[model samples]
Target: MSKFRKKGKKSQPAVNTAALPDIVFMLLFFFMVTTVMRETSLKVVNKIPSATEVAKLEKKSLVSYIYIGKPIAALEDAFGSAPRIQLNDAFASKEDILLFVENEKLDRSEQERNKITWSLKVDKNTKMGIVTDVKQELRKADALKLNYSSKATDNIAN
Candidate 1:
């Protein structure tokens, strides 16, 4: 009925930004609470194997540490000196590692032995051949559940 329709009006869509910040905060809190920290007595850098499928060991008592380095360096590091590997120190060679693991497997209570796990930490500059040789030594000792990890977060290889 008017000479012309009222000038059309456009509505600006409403955007809800309030919930976004809350959601972001919730996610951050969840991750912070759920994160795990690995505990270890000694520190060394190692390059561990990666597998899409793997199993975790339940018992900590059966675990043992293996250190590999140039024969001289390994010996020196095991004993009194800088960069000491004294997480239950007293190992100098493959023989010593094997002996210690064997003793641990035997000394543990029957219940503890059933859930044993072994872990190794070695220097990055160490040779693969030496690493393989050490693995073989561990195998001979009947240390079946072996695990390896880097000493420092920064040293973890891609």
Candidate 2:
């Protein structure tokens, strides 16, 4: 036999997966850190109207949402079918907006406070009266930078 001949039938070595678990855990932690979960459970009937001119918000981090609509079926018995304003997770009166605005402002840095945009998510059939009230509250809060939340539509006239 030649000196350099292969030994019998040497079995191929198995893959060294020593770092596999570390890589898997690293990716898991990365996803856990980067993934954004829903923050609030909506309690209103939020059927936002559509508009042809709807523009996608560029910086969602600087936007705060104000939900306006009648209570959902689950809450109608308690809150009635009248239009209600939802700030975060709870129902709020028009007067509460000022405090809410202040709180939102406080959450951001001084430079970003003025840049924050308040987005009004109003239902299609919702009367203008409540919307007017919300606007008045925002005005009192000096939250003048407002945006109406609406989805993209091909035509509004239809």
Candidate 3:
């Protein structure tokens, strides 16, 4: 009967974290859907040549990139300033072209193999001789479909 009598059992308040995990998962999926990861780290500099007339490629999955450019500052001492071929992430000789094409073809489905296109990302300053050699090697490997990656040019006159 005193002022401080025995009190009834008190309910403890708790933080409701039931939806926290769901929210975290949703954010993770949103980032995954929006992000585009680079397939390979380019070892060479690629300042693509410009062109007036150009076609945009529709299916990126069917395209394989062949980078041709002068060695970047870091690689200048080892590879020199001359333009060179890069397959995947490393510097490659023209002799390795056929084998590279064959290996890339093996990664596609049988029906899609014939549709694979080689996209040449050549530097503007690169000599035509190296580009021509790459084309010849690609032909030897039966990779007939080709695309030259270039920037759009405002100048219409050649």
Candidate 4:
């Protein structure tokens, strides 16, 4: 027999996968820390009206949402069926907007205050009168930058 005769079929070395679990855990933790979830839970039902021309907000930090809709079933027993304005998580009247805007501005850096845009997420079925009142209040508050949040429409006529 030759000196290099078959050494009983030499077995292949296995790959060391001890670091795989650590790598997977690191990736999971990275996504968990980096992802941003919605901060506010909406109390009102919002069926946004569709629009042909819809622009996405660039800086979400510079935008504050004003939800205008009829109160949910639970809140209806307390607030009635009238369209209400939701500032943050609470129901607010037109008069509350001034103070709300001022307070919101105070929370931001002075340089960013001017760039703040108020996004109105008004329900499709809500009355124009309520919307007009909200607009008037925004004007008085000098929070002139306004954005009407609406769903995107493929139809040009919409």
lDDT of each: 0.59, 0.92, 0.91, 0.91
TM-scores, all candidates, are 0.48, 0.81, 0.79, 0.83
Among all candidates shown, the one with the greatest TM-score? 4
Q: How large is the C-alpha RMSD of every model relative to the true structure?
A: 9.0, 4.5, 6.4, 4.1
Per-residue alpha-carbon lDDT of model 3 for 1-119, expressed as tens digits? Answer: 55335433444579899999999999999999988799888878899878889988998889999999999999899989988999998899999999999999999999999999899
Which window of 10 residues has the lowest lDDT sum in candidate 3?
2-11
Error of 1 at 36 (Å): 17
Across 78-145, the per-residue lDDT of candidate 4 in tens digits comes to 88999999999799989999999999999899999999999999998998999999999999988999
Q: Which residue segments of model 2 deviate by more than 4 Å? A: 1-33
Clashes of each: 0, 0, 0, 0
Clashing pairs in 1: none
Candidates sorted on TM-score, descending: 4, 2, 3, 1
- Give me the displacement of residue 40 in model 3, in angstroms: 1.2
What is the Å distance of residue 96 in model 4 from its true position?
A: 0.4
Winner on TM-score between 3 and 4 is 4
Q: How many backbone clashes does candidate 1 have?
A: 0
Put the candidates in lDDT order, highest first: 2, 4, 3, 1
- Tens digit of per-residue lDDT, candidate 1, span 119-156: 66666566577668677876787777777644334332
- How does model 4 score by TM-score? 0.83
Give the per-residue lDDT digits (tens) of candidate 2, residues 20-98. Answer: 9999999999999998888878898989888888787899789999999999999999999999999999999998999
Clashes counted in candidate 2 amount to: 0
Which candidate, 2 or 4, has the higher lDDT? 2
